[model samples]
Target chain A: MTARAAMGVLLASLAGGAGYADELLPYRIEGNAVPVSLTGKPGDAARGRTIVTNRTLGLCLLCHSGPFPEERFQGNLAPDMRGAGTRWSTGELRLRMVDSHRLNPDTIMPAYYMIDGLNLVAPAFRGKPLLTAEQIEDVVAFLATLRD
Target chain B: MKRFHALMCAVVLAAVAGPAGSADIPLDQRRSGYADLGRDTKAMQDDDTSNPASLGVQDGEALWSQKAGTAGKACAECHGDAAASMKGVAARYPAFSPARKGPIDLEQRINLCRTENQKAEPLAFESRELLALTAYIGRQSRGMPIVQSDARLTSAIDAGRKLFTQRIGQISLSCAQCHDDNWGKQLASSLVPQGHPTGYPIYRLEWQSLGSLQRRLRNCMIGMRAEPYAYGAPESVELELYLMWRARGLTVETPGVRP
Candidate 1:
């Protein structure tokens, strides 16, 4: 088989594995409500906090400010997260994380989950999303706890 | 009398805010990454002996006088002394070229001179010889304000502006989002400066070597997860033209040190 075809087979096998079944989940957007059907168990808030601050993984601090006192030089391009839990519901936040463009077409925020219509994606990342569904749930779980 | 006082206050506020209002700072007020450089790097740029880019300039000087190709002509033979003839020449580059039927940067112009005039092989883009020669020529224009292109390049400039503002890549961030909109804001522990093309063929601390403006543009494209245009691509030239136009009054800091 060609190298590309072989690579495709490898990716297919990986996607077919037990844990990766939830990698591609489909959901409909109705107004501001976004229902998430996670195949994994409920997310851990601690894991979510780590993901939010990790530069290589989430890069959330690049444009959004949060209450992470240890991290200096947080970006101010987006809204600050002093009381994000009070501002948005879990479903609303999940929708924004999955595909913010659905809410505001002109938003500069990146869609962490939805993968369609992306341009010039790197070869290894072509068919993959930035974060898995479980990671998204974890982030949502953590964000939901940030009450004022 | 009260209404007049209010009007005067509004006028003063607008004048202080400039054209884009308070959110958009004027170009003159914005500092180049050069200003943000640490003392050691700043000192390196100030003195020729400490500056690494001076090495490229020295190589370029040798290449300038050396004769090559079937014509047996040196750059000095036609252009005369670079000090006198090349002074402020780099400031006017990416000029509209009728022969090329578009805007062409100094690198392309050099390649044209080599191939057409000297009957020599064109230097590869980003090659050692090209970077050195470009650095040499650009060094002559150091401290001079960048010159805006002639009216003929309006269409190309417009096209460049579109590319700058157009959203692309997986991140879906346009150049305007960071450079124009959020300049002075922090991103990943670094301050995002206005994306001006002032000191090109610059000696970047990151690259640890001299590189052209196109190389920097390509880096930004990769950072945004977008496909970068090929070197000497027309689109790249257009963007260069726009950037130079945007920084029309900014002084050239050739071989500038940047973090």
Candidate 2:
């Protein structure tokens, strides 16, 4: 295995001796999308909405303004989240959620799924993804519901 | 009000990232992080009596006169009244150090005096003594404009500017992204400031104690999930040089209280 892969295994072992840390399952980026549901089925959009609005959980509104009228405040850094589903396919959104760095290396969007190549990760979040795969699906499902 | 600041961040980032150190901005556009604070916090910084950091300054005043090291010499012996001697000292760092052949921040310069001048062991970074001393000295420069005084180290400044704009960590964001690009905007519940290096060692609400500029920088590095430089590291000094240069003309507000 590559040095990078070995390091991942080490971190996984550190998590617990199961060779699975946060259980970041394999997912392929076909072109610009994952092309398959991370949980093998679409997630609950209602649950996804809760995650999106949560400051600690999704933190999406911290950088992207959306149609959440009740939020009272939202960020203006990245593109607006309005009409997100109308713009990108569900798989495309999933890939972006997983890691937008592949599309724009300098993008400030955090990779919610991938854990390798990160630095100074706080001990509490050392072996964890920003969002679990289940949470990623929920967010993806919520984003898929956005329309003009 | 540089209303175009939102658009200018990308332009600024592009410029700062490409050239050696092109973090330069028009004088009209530079806004101190103070501009983003709530009224209560600003009021606290304005009032010496009410400011919690005033306590640290009091400790620093005592430290200045107290003798230390084998020589048992006090800072007052050589520097005289801090009010007069240190008036513009903090405002002019991280200045180029002629002896060291690079830039040195106020904190490092203070430690340097301890080890080299007083024959005392240098104070640890962020130690109460260091913070108190720095807080006291920084208070002398309050309301004085931040001035750049470098004989050389333009290369170091360039390196710092590059570091400011270079993307890092799991988040893949640079300093310029949130600070330069998105200052004046809300992130979660807090307002993003322009990331100026004025008025430190500041009394941060999160830390609940006086802390140096390096401490604040480390906080951001950790928040960004990027590896932070060691205290007084070359990278930290260079970043300080660049930030001081960028903050030129902003008034010092030492022992600043912030949420």
Candidate 3:
């Protein structure tokens, strides 16, 4: 798809707003299981990289250090992601992004997609998930390319 | 591959060499920010001359005596000698209030007194005069231990505890995640204190002024990407009650200096 079309799809996905209740998605945890794409298209790694580095969006660097040396002040709270691509498959990365609590009940990482069973969420964000499904796919795509 | 191996080794070594246990105190018996402050900031709090919050206390003292409203009564007129009357008062708040039928912090209590007792307009939360008066009143309790009671505030305290542990916002962090679980651990570049309410209205260099405890709470909520409650919201008061109870025996360090 053209860059403009990709941007249009991303904007449309995000415009779902915070009002609608989150629709649960079904996916298997088996190795290399690919969930159905909400955006109905491949993700752009450039956009994915932007989501991973943006503090307001991804905030991955707040806890997890990555290979982005240009970005100063990466956090040391969680494991570094220098070779994330080689460490985990894209499907595994997707599950972690969607709902990490399924894997580890005690993780401090936020679920970028799942919205059920939250507390004290702002009225504006009561039912909405943090990132759109396309954005999660974009981040997954970006993490898949982190192999050095 | 070599870099990855080195990184793994560093992680393993760090895990094996866990944080020292010598200075680690149980969560219930932690020290106040006064003890956690760096040397320079602690010195600033020790000396009135260098303490910026002292200026607010001075302003608050003036406001205490100034006549206001139709009644034209100063805070000193009814509650004469703040050094004595106000002493240890701050440490007992967010206490249960019969009138409000809920928990009320020192800030809200002051506002209630202004509107009901003094017949004056209630000061806006975080206003200069409000913070000044709060700092002044709180300063009187400087070394007094925080004395929150769960006797009449069990429900409110319980609610606050839930809020403390409940994850919210886009970032999905609860107060316990940083302040409870990782207190004293470095986040970004700063050490996370045990989320106590012992040193407010505190003098934060980041704020460059004295601010109410609610202001600090709102800042945390925003940082976690959660929508903050309104200044006088009961949820904020509930959270304050929980924090005060959590810091039960810690001495009040009003006009506290923090980085």
Candidate 4:
């Protein structure tokens, strides 16, 4: 392998591992809301719905009941997802999607976009948030559509 | 007037001693983890002959009288006929231990008995041998109410109660969130139980083997993405004690089969 090619390979591996996982874009929280978008683009509500209802990726249904009629089991830990959009503005939802702990310290909801202040996170998942910035926007968009 | 005064006094005492074990869930509504189990699993637990954990029970029976160690003593020799002597013993465990100067779970108690009386090495945690013995001893207390009210365990129990509500891990979930507040509600496809420690050496379908309450607690911590406490850690024993206290009036269902 050539030196230039080897450098390229190393860069690729770095991008795929901890280097990528640790890259969390700073977002401003303004009065219980993130007024700006993380991806600099509006999220796809349809894609957001998929993330919300997925068993593994999002696990939102693990604690919150929602309008997914096909999903047989829905959690009762948190408030229902119905009418969420009607309850809060898009910005407020965005802040919540990032870190609900800022809203309520006693909340059991995990910080989807935070890496600090967590206790004993598994080694494999260390420094990794439960959701990426784009994924958080997607979920926020889907939750916002629950206004009806 | 006299009758009303006596009734009011009784009410005041009852209020002072309300079922703090159940916390907020009414006494009648505090369902055991067994209730959340499937019908087939419940059936399996009910029938000792059919229960897979019964195998562990048999293993324990064999170990009871089998002499071992330098002293060459058997548990049965010291405490003969588990039916009589061991009855209700396991139910009150995670009790105060004079030797440890702290709380010790049933597994630790067995090890203590082995080392002190039999002059044997302590069995490893989560080992088949220890599970078997624990199952046997736990079975002896089957159907008996879990009783634990030692004054020495006050601080430890208080710590456990605090831990139960304290959030942990990246998920930042607490025991009270899932097992205490939202119990009987569905978490994905599984029904969350109140998490009473009525059964130890329980046979889980996922494991296809019997495991101790400590093992189960470790699994729960892992579920929260938190590092689990070491087998004989003080925190783990204290948590076990608090769980037993939470399940005070519940009947023991050792060697319980669950899916």
Across residues B1-259, which tens digit of lDDT does each residue of candidate 3 receive? 7777566545533332213221223646686767788899999998999999999999999999999787888999999999999999998888888877779888888888888888999999899999999999999999899886435676777688777777767678878777767776656556778777777888999998888788898988988768998988888888988788777778888888888
Comparison by DockQ, 1 against 3, better one: 1
lDDT of 3 by residue, A1-148 (tens): 9999999988877776553435755555565444555455667788999988887778887777788878877777778888888998887888788888778766788887877777667776766777787788888888889897
> What is the C-alpha DockQ of each candidate?
0.43, 0.39, 0.30, 0.50
Task: Please say which candidate is ahead in TM-score: 1 or 4.
Answer: 4
What lDDT is reached at residue A13 by model 2? 72
Compose the digit string of candidate 2's lDDT tens values, residues B157-187: 7788877877666565778878776777777
Instruction: Give me the overall lDDT of model 4.
Output: 0.84
Where's the lowest-lDDT run of ten residues in candidate 1 chain B?
Answer: B15-24
Better of 1 and 2 by TM-score: 1
TM-score of each: 0.85, 0.83, 0.82, 0.87
The residue ranges of model 4 lying beyond 4 angstroms of the native Cα positions read A1-20, B1-28
Best by lDDT: 4
TM-score winner between 3 and 4, please give it: 4
Could you tell me the TM-score of candidate 4?
A: 0.87
The candidate maximizing DockQ is 4
Where does candidate 4 chain A have its weakest 10-residue lDDT segment?
A14-23
Question: In candidate 3, what fraction of native interface contacts survive?
Answer: 0.46
Superior by DockQ: candidate 1 or candidate 4: 4
